[model samples]
Target: MLIPLIALAGVLPAPALARGMDEPRASLMVGALLAFAAVLAALALLVQARRLRRRDMQLHARNAHLAAANAELREVTERAEAKARMLDGVLAAMADGILVVDAGLRLAGWNPRFPDYAGVPRRALRIGMPLREVIRLQAEAGEFGMVDPEAETERRMAMFHNGTAPQRLQRERPDGSRLELRRTPLPGGGYVTLYTPILAPAAAAAGDAMQAAFRQEWTSRIPRLTAAAADGDVAEARAVAHALRGVAANAGWTRAAAAMEGIEETAAAGALTQLRLLTAGLPQDPAAWN
Candidate 1:
């Protein structure tokens, strides 16, 4: 509207000039100038729109990347937490005393057996607790038996070098239970300690008596069977070999039982030659049997 009005106003002054017809040429120049300006404005708007569109696309791409990264981070965190929970559950369920220590010698974890053995509450355990303090507590509780301080220090040094050592100790419980303690190192770091109750005196004696009687019976039988085989008493040797085979198998001596079975088979087949060869290698002293 402004351009046309200006053109009209300019023409008003140029009516006398319009009679000569130079005004039409002047108006045509003005119109061309307006069209050029409009074209330039359209190009400017198009360029600006393209720039905005590109910026939006870039923002969307960046946002998508951020979302993917956040999702991956969340998944990693969840997996780590789940693993920690599982490890905690397993540690709590174990009957052995497990202690995890860092390279700095600070305690990282302790299992229930720690309190059970030390006669202390779990709350007393702390992250920065010293190894010496733990040993002292057990000693005061009478949990460590006959451990020489110098020997203990040497053993600890050995453990640091070798990564593990099994140490035996005795514990007298408040409940009157006698416990045998064994301490071993964990694979990667730290240590594990186990406490097993010693059998009662009467039960120990009974087991020893049973074992002695079995040993005596085997001592008398094995030699007689070997002698009978040497004397070519094939029938008596076969019977004795069968009995020994059963005894060996029952006692979890599978290899010895198999050898006895072979002897029995050869004897029963009347192959007295193989039976005599087998008897020749039999131990005369039961003490050297194993």
Candidate 2:
């Protein structure tokens, strides 16, 4: 409306000059100039308003995207926490001690049995602590005997760092309990150590007694048993071989048990040649029984 009024004023000024109205023409000219300035200012304000609206829309979009990303991050965190809790519960219920270290050789996780098997206090084995430190503490507690704790710790740490293969060994704790230790490496450059108590004093003593009785039985019986097999006495050979099988199996002599089973089978089948062949070298391989 103001633009059209200014155009009408421009046309009217020429007519006013033709009508010789000089004073009125001058006032009309000033009014037309003000209207034109107002129109320019109005256009500027409209352009600014459109730009503000567009910026507000962009801000809303960005905010929505941020909120979605935050929600996803929170969900992932919750899932990880749930899995961790499940793992913790499973480890706690296990009978053996489990200790896991990270790529940095720092303690990552453990079960309650760790402290018991390691002979170290629970407070001494903190998560994220260096495994060397834990070993030092156990050594100080006399788990490793009278050796220098620092040197022993360094030796153990070197095994992992130097790309050692998985190893299993049995060592005695100062508390009279024997533990079987197994160290396994992770594909991602870390290690896990498991400690399983192998025997109590009573169990070890009983085992020793059983082994002594088995050794005596083998010593007294094998010569006669072999002689009977060599003589083609199938009944006597089978009976003696069966008896030795039971004793060997009970005493954890896997190789000897297998040999005894072969002997029993040959005797039962009356294969005199195979029986004699098996008995021919029995005395020479006595270490197999031991």
Candidate 3:
């Protein structure tokens, strides 16, 4: 390219030479300057091409990184969906009806069998509704005898919140089917209730096992309750007595229930010796519970 520029400059000088030597000198100088400008433009284009290639490579790398991130997010989503389905299956497969509520008593979870077991109208069931509202509807339907609906709802709510209260309740439907509800309060400020029909044969076998286990538990707890009461630890004694009383009442151990109540009261009154005496009176023999 430089050779061609020099040859053209030489021709321009030749045209000038035909006129005079002095004109050829000026024409040659102008031709050389034009060639230098063309070289500079070519260098600028090469620099621009290099910059474009570098930018293209960076974009490709960024696109690959985004694609990898998207794949990971999709995998996590799929795993979460699978776990949710498994939990739903477990709830659905249960034979008994289940109802779970949050700390605020708002309905948190329930199974299909809840409606059938509770005998509550399906229209009253709302996933996030306050459970007291449903109770009010049942009260209006005369589920709690002839009492005012609001009063009964309040009464039941109070019972549920009572730490010492027994949650075992028996209900006879209009069709003469007997069912039992057992509510277990969770440590995390919620409760789960199980509803099952009072079948004779199943109850007979299950009751024996449950009775034995509860008797053992109560006997073991008597010592802890005694220790708490003897130390005049009102909070500890009350908590132990409350738990023991609920279990005893459910097991139909009237004497044990009364004894636990006495421990709670005496500890609160600062009668440490009387509380110890009450704990000592609890019978340890499982047969004595009857």
Candidate 4:
């Protein structure tokens, strides 16, 4: 609409100029002026339209890049959050008591196992409560180690700051449960204390049974074979030592099994005196047989 109006205004000026010229010349000059003006207007409009179109293309490209970057950022954030949730689940499910303390020796975070092992209610745990104070209270109540509380607290603090030594200690609960305590530093100016319960008597008994079986079938055979060698029964001694070697190897006692192998080799070589010497210091108690 505006282009046509501008073209009409240009032609109107040409007619006013034509009044001063002869008829044919006036008509020709008017036509030339009208054509020139129309060409100039069209060129101006073309340049303006090209500039607008280029601006629109640039805007669309910038928006697409921003949308892609935003999607990537959202994906990264979601993955990080998922990992954090997984870590939280793992910590919650752990049997060991875990407590995180800040640089000021104040409790920052803890697992449910903390109160369970400490024999205290969960309400006793709170942020900003001094770690030394908690340790002292628990120790006094026989929840922690037998060491002097003040000295132990100082040692832990020293270990935390130095990073050269491990902050490990032992504690016995009132229920006769033993605990192994260790403290590690967190990345952002804090520390974590982990309390792992020592194996109970029932579990220890089961382990002892397995150990006893191994010893009976292997270690106990050594002395008997040596006695047979002393009695001048080289054949019996060699047979017994060879049997002990197989038993020890099967029980995963590699070093002991190797020793038995060496003894068998010596017996095979008729070195009974060496075998007697090796077994001389072996325990004699019946309980030691196990």
Candidate 5:
């Protein structure tokens, strides 16, 4: 409209221009209005562009913060997974049977050896299984002696609830094997029971008991120790040798313990020839250990 008006002013006759405003003055006023309109439009565009740039910056900052938070969460999760794996490995290597119970005496956790040592079938034990059920299974297996099964279960359950159950007790299995049970209260509200297998019956003297227990274990493991040494499996041989040393010391066999210590020290020092020589003399018969 402004451009057309300017054009009309230019084409107007000299008489028409004289009737209204003069040509020079009208042209000057129209030029000023066009320049003002252009300035206002430019100002509006500049304000709009600034608003868009600010919004983009804010979005980028928010995205960066979220990305950092996500990275931190991932790191924490990985660490937690590593710790859990380490705990599982430790549990798998343990020789004793372990059971973790909640405050209500429900099963919470257990190791692989727990079922065999506790004399309960693998299918019978599960997470959240009640202590009563375990006792019932044991009673059915005649683990609590020749008394009435359900009656014995109820008796034991009563003892557990009333805090009358023994913290440590030794019981013989029907197969003539024995298990030593020791219960320890957890820091929070729960219990952890350890079932250690006794290779022989109780004796009047501790030394006699240890000897009876270790003889069978020694007879069984010596062959494996020799085989590992022959196979050049240094790690396997060292593990076997170390376990035998612990067994010897535990059984009160001073000479055997000293001999095993020497073997382990030699193996650690990478003396494979000495390790083989020591394992070669390992006895495969219980009588030799006695």
Candidate 6:
């Protein structure tokens, strides 16, 4: 390109020579034209080099941003997986059967205890199965007992869907075991249901009566213990302490049993003052005894 331009300039100077020009003057003019062309070429090269450098910098910045974004995404994914594992651990350790359903009423997950508590066959529950389907299966298996299975299924499904349904309900199984069902709504949506076996009403009543009788017996012994303390009779105090400890143990009052043991040790050691002090701290409430 420079050769062609130089040739054209040379021709233009020939024309100038034909018009009129001395040799020394023509040589000076040609030299000046060549110098000006070199300056323009140098400036053009500098501009192109600057443009390439700027483009390289932009590409480097874009690559760095992409790497950073990928790292952040990986970290977020790992954290989510860890949280899911923690949740599973918690559910597995629970005694009651637990079921988690999504906002669409589809089964999301369940604990291992669910099948046993629901009286459903193992592996019968699957992810994405509708909650109504699980209820229908249970109803057909006589979990709701000899009633219209379809009707019971509809009733259960309605109650579960109804926002106003009771959070807790007690239902009896065909085998005579009672289960306490509790429903809890999730924060984002959907619900978690738990089924826990509970004692029958008659058994619970009997338990209450037994506790009352024991409390009465313990109360009757309190008078004797007081008299023994007043009389400073070590033998009587020791006997009363033993009896109280037995009563507390039977009632499953661990704190009360420990207290009684302390009294017994004092009496055995003949520390009447300490024995009386310990007795003074005894629980007065019958319920506290257990």
What are the lDDT scores of the predictions, listed in order?
0.68, 0.79, 0.75, 0.72, 0.78, 0.78
| Model 2 alpha-carbon drift over 4 Å, by segment | 1-42, 145-166, 199-290
The sequence of per-residue lDDT tens digits that candidate 2 reaches over residues 82-127 is 6577456556755579989899999998889999998788987777
TM-score of each: 0.51, 0.53, 0.53, 0.54, 0.60, 0.59
Per-residue lDDT of model 4, residues 1-290, tens digit only: 36755766755645556666788976776677677777877888999999999999999999999999999999899968965764565566565789898977698888888888766668877889887667666666656456676777677557656765467888677788788889887788777888888888898788678768866765567668768878867678778877876665555454555565666767777877886776566553323433
Best by TM-score: 5
Off by over 4 Å in 3: 1-35, 142-147, 160-174, 184-188, 202-290
lDDT of 3 at 180: 85
| Better candidate by lDDT, 2 or 6 | 2
Q: How many backbone overlaps does candidate 4 show?
A: 0
Clash-forming residue pairs, model 6: none
lDDT of 6 by residue, 105-182 (tens): 899989888998887887678899998888888888999889887898888778767766678999889898889999
Mark the 10 consecutive residues where model 2 has the least summed lDDT: 281-290
Which 10 consecutive residues of model 5 have the lowest summed lDDT?
199-208
Q: Across residues 1-290, which tens digit of lDDT does each residue of candidate 5 receive?
A: 34445655565447665559877887786677566666766676788899999999999999999999999999899968965774565566566789999999999999898988877999878899999999899888888779898899999999989999899999998888889999999888779998888754344366466567788887777788889888877777778777886676555454565566677667777778878988886766545654
Model 4 stretches with alpha carbons more than 4 Å out? 1-17, 124-133, 136-166, 186-189, 204-290
Better of 4 and 5 by TM-score: 5
The segments of candidate 1 whose C-alpha lies over 4 angstroms from its true place after superposition are 1-21, 145-189, 192-290
Q: Could you give me the TM-score of model 3 versus the true structure?
A: 0.53
The residue pairs that clash in candidate 2, if any, are none
| Candidate 6 TM-score versus the reference | 0.59
The runs of at least 3 residues in candidate 6 whose Cα sits more than 4 Å from the true structure, single-residue gaps closed, are 1-20, 199-290
Model 3 per-residue lDDT tens digits across residues 47-80: 7889999999999999999999999999899968
Candidate 1: residue 58 Cα off by (Å): 1.6
